[model samples]
Target chain A: MVKSIPLTKADVLHLLSEIVDPEIPVVNIQEMGMLRDVLLSGDSCEVLLTPTYNGCPAMGIIEQDILLLLQQHGIPNAKVKLVYAPAWTTDWMSDSTKEKLKHYGIAAPLHSSCVNWLKPDQITVACPNCGSEETLLVSRFGSTACKALYRCNGCKEPFEYFKCH
Target chain B: MTLQEALFNYLLRLGDNALIQGHRLSEWCSKAPVLEEDLALTNMALDQIGAAQAFLKYAGAIENKGRSEDDLAYKRAERQFFNNLMTELPIGDFSFTIAKQLLLSSFEFFLFRGLSQSKDQTIANIAAKTLKEVHYHLAHSRDWCFRLGKGTEVSHEKLQNSVNALWMYTDELFEMGEADEVLMEAGIVFSLKEIKPKWLELVSGILDDANIALPNVDYMQTGSRKGIHTEHLGHLLSEMQFLQRAYPDASW
Candidate 1:
């Protein structure tokens, strides 16, 4: 008979790294900085996560995914808690992840959201579709909370810009 | 009031406004003038609901009540609710929704910005996060104000009426309670008096550019902070609370 191994913190981390963001499949939760900490004590386990957006529906899915992955890995006493202290920021997103987002046809943020908000007109975003410098913001909101709709003047294609925030 | 009570009341005000306002915006689903507008309103609704959850959850904890965020949102009566009356009022028209969004989003922008500086770390964190979302909502509605305001005579008239009709409720947004004084003194909350000027300046600036006149009204509608609300809030609560009230503790 095969025996189930008790889940270690390293085991949990390795399993969690496999979980991709439900909305943006290209990036894993680890890459997005959603996985804050995972603690394993005896049979109990707790995972702390920070929300990237206040109303991002992906949070529920991510929580469920975490638990399912843990359960499948032979861990039963596990829970996910959402934390708000210090909040979440696009700055925490890595440059490599931004490149991955651009490859997925969504333009990455051009600057830190903290500094860009006041000088919105001065900030420019290149088109992820055509890589054009001339892109006009179609709307502040697009298909989701974290992205804005933009139209490329060069290619005339509309694409989503993962907003500065 | 003790420090905890003041904070609880303050959080209830924050949560109720977002809860009621988000419901009003959700009504625009499948009904907005355009697909983009539909998405915009609903997106804003989702953000507000998320904010409401955070505030209410904190409020519940502060009150030392076993009530969860869902309980505060779903089980509370209308008079028990403290959302600004303007939020509970019906979604009048496309122009009216835009106008209300402009006013509410702008108020939230300044309000949250001030709150980001709160001495309370949790409130500060939520405010900072919410401010980012409200920034987009404000810009979205502000752009529409320009379009509908300058587009055509009929559109302009509708937009003007919305702005004027909503002016009366604007005063209640800045009303400070004795409880708020407790938090304000402790540096846990910002002064609404300080925010009112910033709100007025932003609102008037947009109205000026949109060619809409600021409403001239002597008597502004107040109360709602203390649970006194318009008749519309009762009706809104009936719809929002129906499923939860019918099936107590029911969950998927």
Candidate 2:
């Protein structure tokens, strides 16, 4: 007879937090709030994930990362289900992650309730280089789908801001 | 007309548009002008294919024929396809392809926006989901149109010629036949009469911004909605359905 070790949601969440987003290396799955729910039943585990955007290319890579992480911890048969009804927004990001983004030379997203319109009020996006809010959006779309191109007036350097869709 | 039949026809049109345009865009997979553009075009193609799959699957269920999306996409004859003629035209050159994209994406943006408010919940949901990508596609194509139309003299001339060649085909995009009328009456689909003016204004404004002149050609050809397609559609169908025709049950 084979014995299975008991694991709780906390244990699963801890394991999941170690998984980082492939695109933004500094942020982990927990920081991105992509880890919605984790459930365990016997030897199998079920995970609920929300995509950053529809048709996001990073989804496939994120799924693979989840499987590898859980399997490495001796838990096989982990299933990841994508939920699309309650679309993801930057508001779901953790406070610590927001702070870390600023520290890592990237401006964190602003809280905007309006749809289809970029934030009208020029909220300070602390310069990723000089830690100043003097930055301007150069283009709405950037190199990647999740980012927007912005030039920091303080540092006079261009950087990518993870857009708050 | 019955609701089920209307839904069937409506979904079929949506599926055909996506599948045909997806096929055309896929041709630029490795042939885009720049590396970023290559990926962008392929990404848009993948989005269209995904939307086609979703719409076709819903169509099969409404038809109650046990036909899968692939069955509908691959097995249907040219006359059975309900896509606009604009999508079936050949990709002549880089300039021509960009011009076609600029026109088609703008039309789709307006069409899908109205569709997001459709009475049919399934169609509405899919349209809302797909509109975000369509919005980006329009922006990308519009930016390119301006660059190519206002760039070097050669590029400007080539892009202008491409736009003129494609202008006559734009009328076919807003042609509403019996199926369209039935769906429009049921509020399942929006009327093209309402959609046409906005489409024309947006497209014309983009061309004007690029310093490109709109063709004065008033005579237009229209037949794709009623199953009468251009000479180009048959060749496109043959190439698209070749593998499926050769091996009926082939699986990836």
Candidate 3:
């Protein structure tokens, strides 16, 4: 039987980058900045992940996918740990990912400091579909807690705006 | 309480507050007056449970007893819970529920804002993340309070009575205990005394805008810091803890 070389951390990260986020299939977890760090000892690997929000439902699926991806890539012993310190913010998401989200019909998150809940007029949300500035908030909440429902009059299309934390 | 014990107890109070309030909100799952309201409340409930898990997990780590977040939340007896009595009080009418949230969410917003500066890195980090959510919660509840208070004759009457009834319980949120004293001295926790005035100003301003009178309540309820809660908490725990009790060590 021919033996194969043990995978390195770079190899593992490259392979894991192929796994797309279950919620937003257009962006990989790495591009979303969800993969905090990866540590390898012998053939075993440990991945530290931080969730976008404390209760993001996507975390469980991402953790499972990470483990499965590692296993399929010839690493049998991979552990994924969830950590809360240095809590995640949308700022971690790259500019490229934000553009990808907009192209996929979901508006990217705005800067958190600019959000004033009392004065919706203070914030400007552009519709992802028609790129129009005339968007009304349909609801403070959308399909998920992290998103807000907005409707664009220009295109008459309702879209989910990823809310800033 | 020793400093370590005080820290543990403080964490329990924070965690229990989130857990109990989340459970109360979850009860409106399919029963809300509208579908949007149902989804909104449940979303808030999910955020609270997430906060509860984080605080309780840290508490367990500090205790060094190997108790996970589930063990602390599900296995604890009613008397052992340290959530404010206001949280465990029954969710009465929609008006009452709105009033409850207005008070609780305002309190939480200020509490988390101050706690975000905690000397303990873990607590500060968690508080920073949750503060934004609590801010939105306060906005939602306060907006609804104004609408319900000024809507119609029936709506105004119901909302007025509900806010007045919940006013007395608001004082209990500021009741300090040994745990609070210890944590406050260490800069690991904020002084509830300081947060009270800010909360009162915000509440009073909203009530004024809503054309509702502030109740002159001298008598205040207390005893949550000492693990004393209303009868409603026991029923809530029974329902919440049933699955864990029925199947010990069960995992999916």
- Model 3 residue B42 CA deviation (Å) reads 0.8
Residues B1-252 of candidate 1 have per-residue lDDT tens digits of 899988888999999999999999999999987787788789889999999999999899888879999999999988888889899989999999999999999899989999999999889999998998887888888888999999999999999999999999999999999888999899998789998988999899999999999999998998887899898998999999999999998898
lDDT of 3 by residue, A57-145 (tens): 88889888988878887877789988676777777788898999999999998876787855534788999999999998776667678
Tens-digit lDDT track of model 3 for B128-241: 888878877887787787788889989999999998898888888998888888888998997799989999998889888988899988888888877778889999999999
- Give the per-residue lDDT of model 2 (tens digit) for B1-252: 677887798799899999889888888878977766776677777778877877898899999989999899999999998888888888888889889989998888888889888888778877776776676677777877878888999999999999999998898888777777788888889788898998889889989999899899988977777778888788988998999999997997
Deviation in Å, model 2, residue A33 alpha carbon = 5.9
Q: Candidate 3 — which residues are off by over 4 angstroms?
A: A1-5, A117-121
**Candidate 3 — what's its lDDT?**
0.86
Docking quality of model 2: it rates as incorrect
Q: Which TM-score does chain B of candidate 3 obtain? A: 0.98
Stretches > 4 Å off in candidate 1: A1-8, A113-119
**TM-score for each of the candidates:** 0.95, 0.78, 0.94
List, residue by residue over A1-165, the lDDT tens digit for candidate 2.
Answer: 544636788998998988888878889887897878997776768999976655566888999999998888887778998764354667888788988887776677766454343123344556667776788866545566666567988879988776665
Question: Model-by-model lDDT, in order?
Answer: 0.88, 0.80, 0.86
Stronger candidate by lDDT (2 vs 3) = 3
* Most accurate candidate by TM-score: 1
* Range of the 10 consecutive residues with the lowest summed lDDT in candidate 2 chain B: B34-43
**What does the lDDT read for residue B31 in candidate 1?**
92
Local error of candidate 1 at B162, Å? 0.7
